[model samples]
Target chain A: MLEATIDASLLKDSIESLSVLVDEARVHISPEGIGVKAVDPANVAMVSFELQADAFDEYQAEESEIGLDLTRVLDILGVAEKTDKVKMKLEEDSRKLSISIGGISYTLTLLDPSTIRAEPRIPQLELPAEIVVNGKGFSRTIKAAEKISDHMSMGVEGETFFLEAEGDTDRMRQEMPRDELISITPGPARSLFSLDYLSDIAKPASKSNEVTLQIGNDFPIKINFEIAGGRGKVGYLLAPRIESE
Target chain B: MLEATIDASLLKDSIESLSVLVDEARVHISPEGIGVKAVDPANVAMVSFELQADAFDEYQAEESEIGLDLTRVLDILGVAEKTDKVKMKLEEDSRKLSISIGGISYTLTLLDPSTIRAEPRIPQLELPAEIVVNGKGFSRTIKAAEKISDHMSMGVEGETFFLEAEGDTDRMRQEMPRDELISITPGPARSLFSLDYLSDIAKPASKSNEVTLQIGNDFPIKINFEIAGGRGKVGYLLAPRIESE
Candidate 1:
C-alpha cells in the first residue's frame, strides 16, 4: 500500500496542458524521472518531456518502478471531483492506481511499463547567447511567429532579440528591445526551429511573467520557468531544415 | 467604429477554449445579441454562444455585425501582451480589426459578414425532464461514457438518473441517485444522443460546477450553463440517433 497527497487540480491542469502536444499513451516513468517521447506523424518534429521525481509530493515504489499509460491516468484524474487535496494509492498487484478526491474514488489500470522506451538524448552543444525575459513575453513572441509561418528563425544582437517567420502567404516579425527584457546577455547564437514546438513548450511558462531562455546556434534551446521558487526547465531540440538546392 | 474593453486574460482564455471545439475559418458573429454560432462540418452539432455586453467594460457598435475567420482573430488575441486592458478597433473600409494590449498592436482582416449564416433555432423545445447537477461532474460522466461507446442513452426515473453506453467490446454506465442529485424535476422523457456532441458542448460547463440538463423523449437534449451569473448562455443542439430495428 502506498499513499501520496497533492493539489489535485494543479497536477491535473499541468498534465492536461502538456498532453495536448504529446501523447499520453506511452510515457516513461522512473524513480528518477517521468517522461514522454513521440515523433510527429510527419516525421519532421519530435517531442520529449521529463519531470523529475522531485516534482512529486511523495515519490515511492518499493520494487516495481514502471511506466504507465498516462492517457488512462489523465482520464481518471480529469474526472476527479475537484478539491483541495488528491490522494493516490497503489494496490498490492501494482496494476492499478486508485485516486480519491472530494469523496470520489476512481481506479485506473496501468500498462506494462516496459513497453515505453527512453528517449535518446541529442548531443549537447555550447549555446552562444542566453536571455532572460518575462515568460509571458516569450509566449507572446512565439504566438506571433506562429501566425506568419510554422517555422521561425531567432537571433540575438547586442540588446535586441528577434523572431522572424516568412511563408508564401504571410510574413511576421517580432523584436523585443533589450531594456524591456529582464536580462539579455549576448553570446554566439542564431537558430531556426519549429514554432509549434516552441509554443507547446511555452505553455507552463505562460503562467508566470518571468522566464529565462538559453539559445545556441542550431542546438536545443533551454527555457526555464519558476514554480514555487523552484525551476522547471523545458529543453527543446529542433533539427535545422536542410535547404534543397 | 467599434470598441470594447475586457479583462485581456479572461477573454483570451475563454476564446482559446472555444477555439478548440470551433473551426476558426467560419464563425458567425451578430450584434442583435452578443453571440457566435457555428455548425460543425458534419452538421451533427451546432454550438451557440452568447456573452452579455456586461462581460465587457465597454461594448459599442453602430448596429453593425461581422463574420471573421476566427483563426486570425484568435491568433491576434492569443498573442496580446498581458495587460490589464485589451482594446479593439474596427475599420470599415480596410475591413480589419485592430487590437492593442500592453503596447502591442495586431490587425486582422475580417471576412464578408454576409457570407456568415445565422443558426436557426428549433421551435422552443418543450423538454419533459430537467435535472441539475455539478457541471464538472456531468462532463466527467460523459467523458467516461465516451470511453466505452460513441452513443449514450440518458434516462430519468423519478429522481434517479442514468447514462448508459454499450458497444460490442465495452459497456459503461453511470448512475446518480435522486438523493445525491442537486435537483431533479421530472418532465416528459428520456433520450439517446451522440456522445461526441455532448462532449463538445460540455467544455464551457467545466468552468462551473453546476449545470442544468433538459431532456425530452427521443428528442434533442438541451444543456445550459450560466456564464457571468445568468447574463450569458452557452447552449448546444444535438440530433438524437435513431436506434435500428
Candidate 2:
C-alpha cells in the first residue's frame, strides 16, 4: 500500500529517465523513497534510479515491489501542466493504481512484479577519470558524433576531455578543456562506446545542469546526475563496445 | 536574366504558400513582380500567388517563365536563419538558379517550363458573404473540426459565423460573433469543404494576421491574405463538396 503527491514535472522527468532504458521496470517502494534497478533487454546498459520521500509533498508507503509500464504512465501525464500536483494511491488489496491530476483521474492496472526480469546487481567500478560537464553541452556533442559514426570515443588527455567519432568518409571531434568543463579529474582513460546507448542516455542527462561521467580504458562508463531539484538521482552504466581491428 | 536579394524567411514563406498546392510550378517573373497560378493534381483547388518587386531588397528581371521544384528550394532554404539575406541569380543561357545564403551556395536545377502543367485560368467569383478573421483563430477551428470529421461547414448565420464538423460518433462547433471577428458580412452563404484541402491551405493562412474568406451558397470559397510584410499576396479557390441527401 502506498500514497504520494508530487510535482507533475518531477514525476514525469523521473519516469522518463527510466523509460529511456527500459519499457517496464520493477519499482521498489519503501518508507523512505522509491527505487528502480533495471537493465536493457540487450544487457548492454543498466539504469539505477532513486526518488527521496522528501521529493514528494506527501508520502506514505510500506516496503513493496510492483511492476510499472512506463510508457502507459507517460501517455497519461502528457496532458498535465508542469505546475500540477499528481496524486497516486494504491490500496493493500487493489491491483490498480489510482492517479489523479487536475480534473482527470486514471485507473492504471499494475503489472505483476514477478513477471518482470529480476533486478540486476550493479557492479562496482573504480574508474581512473571523472568529468563533470553541462548536460546541454554533453548532449550536443553526442548529437554531433551521431552524424559521423555509430561509435564514439571518450577520453581524457592532460587537462582536456574529448569526444571523437569517425566514419568512412567523415570525422568529428569536440574537445572540452578543464576551463570549459565544470570539473575534471584527468587520468589515462580512453574508451569507445556505442552511440546507440549514449544517445539514449543523453536524453535524460540533457535536462541536468551537471552530469558526472567516470570512465576507464577499455571499460564501461558510469554516468550520474540529479533530477527533481536534486531530490532524486539517476545513474547509468553502459558497457563499452570493443573496437574491431 | 534575373537577379534578386530578399529576406530568407520571406522567400521561404512565399514558396511554401505555393508548394502546399503543387510540387512543381511555372513561375512568371516580370519586371514588376513574380506570379504563379497552379492547380492541385486533383484539380479541386487552385492557388494564385504574387510577390511584388518591392518585396525584394534588390530586384531586376526580364520577362521570363521558369519551372521550379518547390520542395527542392524549400529544403535548401531550411538551413537559413530567418534574418539572413538570400541572393538568387539566373543567367540567360543557364538552366540553374544560383542561390547564396550566408556562406552556403547551391546551384538548383530548374525544371523545363513546358514539362509542367499549364498555368490555370483563375475563375471570377463574386461571393455574397465576406468574413475577415484572425488567422490563428481560424487555424484552431480547422484543427478542432479535423478531430471530428473529414469535412467541415462554414457559414454566416444572422451576425454569427460558425465552423462545425460532425463524425459518426463525435461533433465540434465554433461560433464567432461579429464582436469576436475582425469583420463578417452575413448572407445565405453556407458550403462544405474537404478538410484535406483546407488543412493544407491553413499552413500559410495561419501566418497572416487577417484572412479574408468569401463564400456563396453552394459555391466555392475564396481565401486571400498578404505575406512578406504586405508586399506579397496569395489567393486560394477551393471547389465546394456537394452534400448528398
Candidate 3:
C-alpha cells in the first residue's frame, strides 16, 4: 500500500517539458533528495537534476529507490483526467506499479530497478564564482541565444553577468549589470555550454520568477529554483568544445 | 528586382496539409481557387512553422499579390504540409495564385471562413440497409466493399452480404460471403459513393483497429479516420449509414 499526494499535473508537466532534451531516464531518490541524470546520446552534454524530498507533500518509503522506464509512467500520468490526487500501488509481485485516479486505472510494468546504472558522483569543483538572477531573465537570455547559435558562452566579472553567442554569420549578446541582475555577487569565472539543452530544461524552471545559478570555469553549471517552497536543482554539465585553430 | 529560390518548404507543407481540411483563405487573387483560408480559432489547432522563400534556389515575384498573416495562411490550409513543393509569386495587385503540387491553386477568400460550421451540403444518398464494423475492418472492407457491397447486400437470401454487431459490452461483427456474392450483381443495388472523403476526414477512424459504426438510417453514418495520405481524402465513409437506422 502506497499513499502520497502531490500536484501530479505540475510534476508531469515538468517532466514532459524536460524529456524533450535528453534521454536515458534515470532519477535518483534518497531520504534527503531526489535527482535525475541523463546524458545526450552524443555524450557531449549531461543534465543532472536534484530536488529535496521536502518538496513532496508526503514522501514515504521504507526504502529509498530509483526507477527507470519513466516514459510509461509519464504516459500514464499524462492520460490522467487532471491534476487531482493520484494514488500508486505497487503490487506484491513488485513488477508493476498501478496508478489510479477517481475511476481511471492505468497499470505500468516496471523494469528491474537493479538493471539501471547507478548515478555517478558529480566531481566537486573548487573554482570560484556564482551568480543569482531572476529566473525569467536567465530563461529569456538563453532563448535569445537560440536565434544566434546552438552554443552559448557565459561569464562574470565583479557584479556584471554576460551571455554571448557568436557564429560566422550571426552573433547575439546580452549583459545584465549587478544592478540589473536579479541578485549577483560575483567572482571571476567563465564557461560555454549548449543553448539547446539549457533552453529545453529552462522550460520548467521558468515557472518560477527567480533562480540562482552557480558557475565555475569549465565545470558543470548548477541552476537552482524553488518549487513548492522546496529547492529544485538542475546541474548541467556541458563539455567545453575544443577549438582547432 | 528581388528574386531568390527558397526550397519550397513552408508553402508546400502548409498548403497541402491545410487544403485537406479548409477550402479557402481571404486574400483575393486573380483566379477563383488559389487563395488560402484560416482555420476557425476554436476548432483549429496550432502548428509551428518557419520557412523563408530565400531558402529555395529560385524565387521570382514581379509584384506582391497578397501579404497574409501566418494565422490566416494556416487556416486556409486546414491540414497543412502534405508535400514540399509549395511555390508562390504575385502577378497583378488583385491576384496571386500559388501552385501547390496535389491540386491547382484557386483564389477565393471565405467570408468569415474562420467560423466553424458543418459542411453546407450533405451528399445525396439512395443507399439502403447498412452494416457496422470496426474502423480497420471497415477500412479493409471498404477496399473490398468497393467490389462486394458495391451493388449487393446479399440479404438473408443473398449469398455474399450479411450484417451483424454482437454483444452488450464486446461489440464485434463481420460480413463476408463465400461465393460470387462477394463479386458483382447490380440487381441488389446497395449504394454508391467515393471513399475519398473517409480517406480524408475522421480523426478517430485510425485510433482503433476496429471502428464501431452505425449504418443506413437516413444518410450515411460517417466513419472518421485519422487523416492519412497527403491529399486529405476521407479514409472511410459509407452511404448506407444514411438510409439504414
Candidate 4:
C-alpha cells in the first residue's frame, strides 16, 4: 500500500531523468523514501536516483516495490502546471496506479517487475580528482561542445579543471580555475566521454544549483546533484571512450 | 541604396513570420516603410508584412526591391539578443546584404530578384464577417484543434463565433460571443480551412495582443495583427478548403 503527494514539477523532472535510460522502472518505496538504480541497455552508463520521504507533502508506504511505465507517467504529468501538486496512490489489490492532479486523474496500468532487468549494483571507485560547479555553467559548456564534436574530454591540471571538444574544423575549450568553481582538487586525471550521454545527464543536473563531479583516468566519471530542494539526490556514471590513436 | 537600424527582436520576429511561409522574399524598400508579399509554395497561403519608418531608429532608402534568403538571415539573427540594435545596409553594386548586430556583422548573399516568382497582385477581397480577439487565445484554439483534426470550420451564428475540429475519435471546439471578443460584426458566413496553414500562421500572430479576422462563406479568410510595439502590421490570407457534403 502507498500514497503520496509531491510537487508535479519535481516528480516530472525525476521521471524525465529516469526516462532518459529506460522506459520503465521498478522503484523501491518505503516509509523512509523511494529509490531507483538502473543501467542503460548499451551498458555505457548507470543512473541512480533517491528521494527522501520528506520530499513529499505527505507520504505513506510499507516497503513496496512499485513497477511503473515512466514514459506514461511523464505524459500524464506533462499536463500539470509547475506549481500543481500531484496525488498518487497504489491500492493493495489493483494493478493500476492512480495519479491525480488538479481534478484530473489518470489510471495507468503497472508493468511487470519480473520482466524488467535486474537492478545494477552500485560500483565502488576511488576517484582522486573532484570538481564542483554551478550546473548551468557545466550544461552550457556541454551544449557549446556539441556544436563542435560528439565527444569531449574532462580533465584536471594543476589548479584548473577543463573540458574540451574538437572537430575537424573547430575546437572549444572551457577552463575554470579553482577560484572560479565551487571546489576543485586537481589530481592530474583526464578521461574522454561521449557527449551524447553527458548532454542528457546535464539537462536535469542543470536545474540544480551545484553539480559535483568525480573523475579518474580512463574510468567512469560520476555526475551527482540534488533536487526537490535537497530532499532528493541523483547520481549518473558514464564510462569513458578511450581514443583509438 | 538602403541603410536602416532597428531593434534586433523586431527584425527577428518579422523574419520568423516570413520564414513560416517561404525561405526567400523580395522586399520593397521605400522612405515610408519596408514591405514583403509572398505566397507559400503550396499556393495555399499568402503573407504580407510591413514595418513603418518609425519602427526603426534610422531609415533611409531609394525605391528598390532587394531579394534575400530569409532562412539564412534568421539563422544569423538567432545569435542576436533581443535588445541589440541591428544595422542593415545594401549597396547598388553588391549582391550581398550586410547586417550588423552587437559586434558581429554577417554578409549574406542575396538571391536574384529575377529568379524569384513574380509578385502577386493583392486580391480585392470582400469578407463580411469580422471578429477581433486575443491572438494568443486564437492560436491556442488552433493548436488544440490540430490535435483533433487536420481541418476545422470557422463561422458565426446568432451572437457566437465558433471553431471546431473533429478527429476519428475525438473532437474539440472553441466559441466566443460578441461581448467576449474585442469586437465582432456578425455575418451568416462559414468556411472550412486547412488547419495546416492556419496553425502555422497563428504561431507568429499568437504573439500579438489582438488578431482581426475577416471571413466569408467558403472563401478565403484574412488574418491581421500588429507587432513591434504596433510599429509593424502583418496580414495572412489562407484559401478555404470547401467541405464535401
What are the candidates' C-alpha RMSDs?
Answer: 12.5, 9.0, 16.6, 9.1
DockQ for all models: 0.13, 0.04, 0.03, 0.04
CA shift at A168, candidate 1, in angstroms? Answer: 6.6
- Model 2 lDDT per residue over A16-110, tens place: 99999899999999999999999999999999999999999999999988889999999999999979999999867647899999979998999
lDDT for each residue of candidate 3 in A1-245, tens digit (9 for 90 to 100):
23344567756754654465453365545566556776666666556666565666666543345454655556546534465666655566655555554333345555665776555556666546667777677788888899888888888866788888987799998888888867776877678888877887677667766677777766667665666555665555556653323
Model 2 stretches with alpha carbons more than 4 Å out = B1-245
lDDT of 2 by residue, B191-213 (tens): 99999999999999999999999
lDDT of 4 by residue, A82-200 (tens): 89899988878636676766544445567767778779998998898999989998999999999999999999988899999999899999989989999988886889999999998
Give me the TM-scores of chain B across the candidates: 0.86, 0.98, 0.30, 0.97
lDDT of 4 by residue, B1-245 (tens): 78999999889999989989998999888899899999999888999999998899999887888788888898898899979999999967648888999988888788888888766776989898999988977876776566557998899988788887766543455668788889999897899999988989988998988899999899899999998788889999999997976
Interface RMSD in Å per candidate, to 1 decimal? 3.5, 9.1, 14.0, 7.5
Total residue pair clashes for candidate 4:
0
Q: Which residue pairs show backbone clashes in model 1?
A: A128-A188, A135-A209, B128-B187, B128-B188, B135-B209
On residues B1-245, what C-alpha lDDT tens digit does candidate 1 reach at each position? 56777778656655644554564523333343366666666767666677777777787755566656665656666666456578776777636666666655556666766666555554477788888888888889889988888889888877688888888799998888777788888765768898777787777677766687888789887776777666667766677888653
**TM-score of candidate 3 relative to the true fold:** 0.50
Stretches of candidate 1 above 4 Å error? A1-140, A150-245, B16-21, B24-33, B71-85, B101-103
Candidate 3 global lDDT = 0.49
TM-score for all predictions? 0.55, 0.55, 0.50, 0.56
Q: Compared with the true structure, what per-residue lDDT tens digits does model 3 show for residues B102-147?
A: 3546353324423433233334444443333345444443333222
